[model samples]
Target: MDLPRSFTIRESGHRIHNPFTSEKLATLGRALGLAPGTSVLDLACGSGEMLCTWARDHRVTGTGVDISTEFLTAAHARATELGVTDRVAFRHGDATGHVADEPVGVAACLGATWIGDGAAGTVELLRRSLAPGGIMLIGEPYWRREPRDQATVEGCYATTKDDYRPLPELLELFGRLGCGVVEMVLADQDSWDRYVAAQWLNTRRWLDAHPDDEMADEMREDLATGPVRHVRYQREYLGWGVFALMNR
Candidate 1:
């Protein structure tokens, strides 16, 4: 019913959880031209940043579902902080099969497509909750450059070369699924650094404060190796973006 403690611990300080920076997220929101009272459904919405922020900026109302109670707590707090408590809601639940009770203007599964098994399945899941002509937002990673070897692929955290497609293939995927790629905001190397490097500091700070905790050793190892692996393999070979789609 909840995410692993280690997962939340590693991202304890993250608001948007993915490689997207605040500016990139805001840009996507603006690009959509969200209107007041536009309803959104966000699955696997880590910390509910997208929902809460859009609720404030665009006056969109939304529900965010996640399996992490810790993240849900933070999401609720963020809604209150942004003075948008009436506009957004966060529920602690599995996002895999969840759908909006009512069709929404936007249906999203950002950065956690695995909830529906993969991009295609995730799109299917989102479509179940999308109103006619509604936008679907999918956040995913792509190969920036083809990896040279299996070792490099593993270093980038992919078990195989097929784990992620290149950008063009990803756009083609949307077309195959009967969706048109309408807009996208990509992550730069600096955004990747901001996302991955910040995790190291969160892990390190947790280790300093809880050296005797059961997961301390694991956190220490991640802190020691994560940055090197990220900069050398992932940051250079991987790119991430949140794409906006409309049914074709």
Candidate 2:
């Protein structure tokens, strides 16, 4: 019913929980042109930043589901902070196969497409909860440039180059799924650094506070080596974006 403790600990300080900066996230929300009372269902919604922020900015109502109790707690607190508790609800549960009780104007599974195995299946799962003319938002990674070798692919955190398509092919995938890519907000290198490098600091702080914790060594190792790996490979070869789609 939850992500591993280590995973949550590593990202405990993250607000958006992805490579997207707050500005990029707001841009995507504005691009959606949401109307008052528009319903959104965000699967794997991690701290529910999008739901809470959208509720405040766009006056949309939404529900978020995530398997991490820790994250769900933060999400609820964020809703309260934004004074949007009345507009959003968060549930601690598995996101895989999750569906909204009512058809929604937007359905999203960002950054955790493994909920449906991969991008194609995740799009199908989101479609099940979407109303006609609703938008589907998918946040996914793509290859910025073709990797030169298996080691390069692994450095980008993929077991194989096929794990992610190049950016052009990724866009082509939406068309194959009967959805048109209407809008997108991409993550720049600065955002990527913020996302990944911030985790190292969080890990270091955690390690300093709990040197005796069983996970300390692992966090220490991550803090020691994560930066170079990221700057060397991920920043160079990987790209991420949130794509907005509508059924054709």
Measured on C-alpha atoms, candidate 2 has an lDDT of: 0.94
Go through the candidates in order and give each one's C-alpha lDDT.
0.94, 0.94
Candidate 1: residue 137 lDDT (0-100): 97
Model 1 scores what on Cα lDDT?
0.94
Please give, for residues 1-248, the per-residue lDDT of candidate 2 as tens digits.
78988788889999889999999999999988999999999999999999999999999999999999999999999999999999999998899999899999999988999999999999999999999999999999999999999989999999999999999999999999999999999999999999998888888888889999988888788788889999989999999999999999
Candidate 2 regions exceeding 4 Å error are none
In model 1, the Cα lDDT at residue 109 comes to 90
Can you write out model 1's per-residue Cα lDDT over 1-248, one digit (the tens) per residue? 89888888889999989999999999999999998999999999999999999999999999999999999999999999999999999888899999899999999998999998999999999999999999999999999999999988999889999999999999999999999999999999999999988888888889989999999988888888888899889999999999999999
What alpha-carbon RMSD in Å does predicted model 2 have with respect to the real structure? 0.7
**What TM-score would candidate 1 get against the native?**
0.99
Among residues 3 or more apart in sequence or in different chains, the pairs in candidate 2 whose N, CA or C atoms overlap within 3 Å are none
